[model samples]
Target: MTDLSLIRNFSIIAHIDHGKSTLADRLIQITGGLSERELKEQVLDNMDIERERGITIKAQTVRLDYTAKDGKTYELNLMDTPGHVDFAYEVSRSLAACEGALLVVDAAQGVEAQTLANVYQSIEHDHEIVPVINKIDLPAADPDKVKLEIEEVIGLDASEAVLTSAKSGIGIEDVLEAIVTKIPPPSGSRDKPLKAMLVDSWYDPYLGVVILVRVLDGALKKGDQIRFMQGGTQHLVDRVGCMRPKIEQLSEIGPGEIGFITAQIKEVEQARVGDTITTVKNGATEALPGYREPQPVVFCGLFPVDAADFEKLRESIGKLRLNDASFSYEMETSAALGFGFRCGFLGLLHLEIIQERLTREYDLDLITTAPSVVYRIQLGHTKTEDAQEILLHNPADYPDPSRIESIEEPWIKATIYTPDEYLGSILKLCQDRRGIQTDLTYVGGRAQVSYELPLNEVVFDFYDRLKSISRGYASFDYEQIGLREGDLVKMSILVNGDPVDALSMIVHRSVAEDRGRHMCERLKELIPRHLFKIPIQAAIGGKVIARETISALRKDVTAKCYGGDITRKKKLLEKQKKGKAKMREYGNVSIPQEAFIAALRMGEE
Candidate 1:
């Protein structure tokens, strides 16, 4: 049995591009977890998109054997996690499995938005934190200034913080020593009934499904009958193992240890993340706490460019769900885009990742609609308690305004970190989006402001605008603040005279005209000239708010005249003009598929 006192489990947290993955590589090199030939930059970031974007998408866990300065060998598990706000749930699951955290900050950039958000999460989990400032080798690095910011903003003493440059391998040994001395060892009892938390999972053809978990109490072994309390499904363990930089079979993993279990479970949903695992025969008295099913916030419709690829799209998503369980999709049909699925995601980033994966992994051509948020509407008439409330995600299902007593939308609490010079611009942007300032503070030269903003406002090009105003110097993070009453109206677009359901959107009543005008103008640019004039109109409810017209293609009817008299040419031209007018009165305007998408994609990035 492993000594719990000599084992330490911890996670690395930081804002995106703050060198969290790079620091993990340095520590892995220092501990000799993998040989030089097997080691590479961002080793823990296994996804291609993650490596290309220089971000961590999924949390990675690996066990290391480190020899402390006191000549004692210790087991260290590094729970490398995603830093984006879209993956906050992933960060929380990682923190729950660790006894401590190494808060990594960029030496030159100081503390940003995600830095403070993740630190508070670590503190909330009651984990011991050790601040580490990375990228010190940069010419503009100011480690001293960052230490002070960490102390003042995060409320954590950084006098003992380690400063290192993962690029140059400086102070690598110091970081290892800090992990051994500063981070506390794991604490739990091995004698209790089995209680494990499933933190991550993946599917394999040979093994069916495999789950990674942290043993909160007792032990698990091969052939043990296990059951997930949240899923309520039982299975006999097929194999028990550990990731020692590579998979290695083990007889049993005791308390406070991180390991894997493949229990002949075919479905990934049965071994969901944040669920508790226990022995089916001699179960723990109760399940572990803090298990929550992921609730999707952003929604969109995805359809294939070719109708025959519908089955292929379904198969691809099923494979993806084997790895990503947070995203949900159902069969949905559209008049403009054809048959597709209505998919739900945690946020915009999550939706983008899933769509990109389907396109790349499955080699499928997909058409996606504009992303939207789920809405809560209170109907005017109700026969029962359940009948009073209704949830709507698609704009096509919107009811009459008279029937809706009130409409509510989701709101979020956002934390923005930016330089003091751009504070006024950011404040103006937030106020324009209906944000209510809750707290404002300054840490050294940086301004950290907190505001409560509507989810629809933030999800619509807010991040892009924040970067544009700050010139890429600002970082932001947010959490859902629940739904509240909103003055929202469904806006529709028309091509010629026909309404397009795919171009429908929900917008605030105050800015309806402005948003409508922009949509009509943008649609005019994307639509090609037809035989007859095409009118693009944007309407809120039954009232038209904006309009634009695209002129038809003109043809030279008298061009074939061969030395004809001037009277003959004039008569021919006049006759052709009348024909054009008649066609415009009775002919239909054919709009390109791209025009339908362009209207909904108007306004901003």
Candidate 2:
């Protein structure tokens, strides 16, 4: 029997690019969890996109038996998480599975936007935090200064903050020692009914649905009938296993342990994340209360570049969804782009990664429409009865003008951290985006500013602009602040008098004209010149805001003539002009598919 007293379950939390993944790699090395040949960079991060982007996409759990200087062997479970703010929900789910967290920070950079957000979350979870200042090998490493900053900003005792360089293997042993001493073992009783927290789950072709779980109470064994309390579904446990960086079949696992369970489930929906698991016959009466269905904030259309590939794209998404439950899609059609799926995502990076995976893993080319935030549009009582209100997720679904009484857009409170020098530029950029400054403070020569801005504004180049203004020295984190009334209108782009739904966008009424003008001008450059003039116009509710024209293709009238008199040349020129006029009278302009895509990114710098 394993002693519950000698176990520590904790996760690593840090800002993006703060070396959380590398630190995880170092810990694996010091513990000798895997052989030298078995070791590689970010062993826990399993995705190729994650490796190439140098970010952790999924929260991976690995178990290691670490022998401490106290002459006792301890089981340490490390749940390394994604650093981007988009995965905040995932972060919370991973934290709930642990009793403590290793708060990692960049030695030179000190505290960042996401670092503070995650630290606060850890505090809320009541997880014991062991601060570790990483990247001490860098020339700019300032452990002492960062220690004070951690104390000042986070209110945590930084005097004992571990200083380590993941690259040089410095202070790796100390980090392990701190984890054993500082983080308390989880408190639970194996005598109780089986209760496990299913933090993540995915589909395996052979095994079907495999769930990553954290045991909170009792014991889970193979062949036990289990019930997903929240899902109200039961299954027979097919396999019991743990990831020691590899899936090792285990006979049984007790409290404070992290492992996997193949429950003979065929679909991902059966094993919803954050749901509680218990024995089917004598399960706990109350399910865990933390389960929440992930709500996607950013939405866009994903259409097959080739219309015939729609079914393939749908199947590919279905397979991927079995892995990522947060990613969602529904069948949708566009007047401009044929049948497609309207997909929802956690954020821009999540959206991009899924798109990339679909293209690479499934070998399917896709046409992705411009992303949009959900809007709440209220309509007064109809002619017959009750008031009508609509929640619009796609711009193409905007209702008629007369039905819209008011529009409300989602807003978020964004915290931006940067040096004092770029305050002016940051201020201007926020104001232009219609952001309302809520608070500003200075900490250790760095400026921390908070703004309440529309979610749509942030989705559209806000983060990129913040980095550009601060010269790449800024970090930002935001949380939704609910919806508020806004003067918003749906602006549409017309090519050759035909509306292109993919090019439509919801913009503030004040900047509708400016945005329309920009869109028209951008379309003029992107749309090819046809035999007849093509008119590009932007309008709101039938009111034209801006217009541009792609001039007709012109040919040299005398280029093909070898030798001709002046009269012959004049006659040829007149005949050519008459033919062009005739063509213009009856011909229709054909706008290629790529033009619509180009218009979506034309506003981006």
Candidate 3:
């Protein structure tokens, strides 16, 4: 076994597109973990969607062997984490397993919202942070300026920060040297009882459940019986290994070491992330502190385009749940969309990723409803203590406004970083969404602005509009603040006098009319014209707020009456009118799947 002092556990933290994965590639190459032929860009990002989007979805870990200037071989455990706010939970869990973190900042971009957010998390975990200014090869790169921003904004000293171009091979050795000299080795004792932290787990077809763990106290060997402290489930460890970007078998994982173990556990739910694992025979009396459960911020309904695919959709969703514990779903039947599932996600991006995976990976066509945030509804007008409270996920389930004493909607504290030129428009956008500005400051050429906005307003197309207004130069990140009282109402869309449950949404009463009108107008353009005139209306509590009418297709029934008397022509027209009215009364408006998809994708234009 290697000495504890010769091992270092650290994670790379940065904003999206700040080169965390690229830096990981260079480190793995320098350490000889993978040959040049086998090494590629984003080697740690294994999913197809991740490579396509040029983003890391899942946090990946690798063990590298690096020989330092002291002529001593050292084992480095590196956790490469995602940079998006939606995957911040993954970063948190990864940091909990490491004693130090490498903070990467883009030299040209300077400090961003996510950069500040991630640094704060590392600080909370009490990690020793090594600042690295990356992308120094770019023409616009200003390492000195970024160093100052890191110091001013993140409150981390950057005077001794390493400058490197991860894309090229410059300053790679200095980074490795800094990690060895600056970041302290993990502390643990092998003589104590086995106490391992379950960092993550996933499903493997052949191996069943593959669990990633960090040993804190004693060594974990193959063929040992392990017990999970949270679930109280015991299993026999069948294999122990570490990922050197590829699986390498290990006889045992000693104290302060990170590795993976397969215990033939059939389901991933049994192996909870952040749970304590120990020897079943003489397990530790007290359990390690577990992670806080991830709360879903946005929710929407996902329905298969074809009703016959319900079973297939269920199976696909179940398989996905095996890997992602943050995503939650429940079966629900909709009058308009038939059978479907109401799903909850951490954020809008997380919801999008899951929907895309359902379509691309499972080969199923899906229709997603408008995203909504959770709200707390007080049921009665009686005293606050006596009134019952319910959490509302879907607007269709929204209780009557008269019955609800008050509604409390979730709000978020948001931080936005943008170039000075776009600051005015960004502020205006936030204000339009009912935001309350908390603070605003200037960091060099960029403006750092913070606001408290309702989660309902930010959930729908806010990110898209922000990107467009700022010309893609702005970065935004947010965390949920507790619910606040809001004057909100549920607006339902009715086609031919029948309410469409999937199109209903909760909106503030002040903008309900404008929002309702926009929805009606969009539906008018998307829904195909039928033989009978179709009337679409947006209503709240039986009161119509907006209306649109799709005029019926005209077929000339009087054409055959050419050269006839005026009375005959008039008679034929009257008959046609009567038939149309009857059809309108009895006919069911068959809304095509595309119409639902397009209508729900509002404000994209």
Q: Which candidate leads the pack in TM-score?
A: 3
lDDT of 2: 0.89
- Please write out the lDDT profile of model 3 over residues 22-123, one tens digit for every residue: 999999999999999999889999888898888888888999999999999999999988889988877888898999999999999998999889889999
Model 2 per-residue lDDT tens digits across residues 1-605: 37889989999989888898888998888888788999999888888999898888888888899999999999999999888888888889899999999999999898999999888989999999999999999999999999999998899999999989988899999999999999999888998888899988877888888899988889989999998888899888989988888789999888878899998788887788899999988788898877788889999999998999999998999999988888789999987789999999989889989999999999997888888988989887777756788889999888878877899999999999999999999999999999999999988989999999999888888878888889999899988889999989999988877788888999999888988898898888877788777788999988889999989888888887777678888898899888887876676766677877777766467
Task: Give lDDT per model, in order.
Answer: 0.88, 0.89, 0.92
Backbone steric clashes in candidate 3, count: 0
Candidate with more favorable, higher TM-score: 1 or 3 = 3
Which has the greatest lDDT? 3
Query: What is candidate 1's TM-score against the reference?
Result: 0.95
What are the per-model C-alpha RMSD values against the true structure? 2.4, 2.5, 1.9
Question: How well is each residue in 1-605 modelled by candidate 1, as lDDT tens digits?
Answer: 78998899999989999888988888888888889999988998888898998988888888889998899999999999888889888789989999899999999999988888889999999988989899998999999999998888888999999988888889888888888898898878988889999999888788888899999888999989988898988889889988866788899989999989898887787777899999998888788888899888999889898889999999999899988888899999988888899999999889878988898889998878878899999987645433378899988888877788889999999999889999999999999898999999988888899999999887778888999999999889999989999899999988877888888888889877887898888888888888668888999877899999999887877788989689989999889888877887787766666666555555455
Name the weakest run of 10 consecutive residues (lDDT summed) in model 1.
596-605
Give me candidate 2's TM-score against the actual structure: 0.95
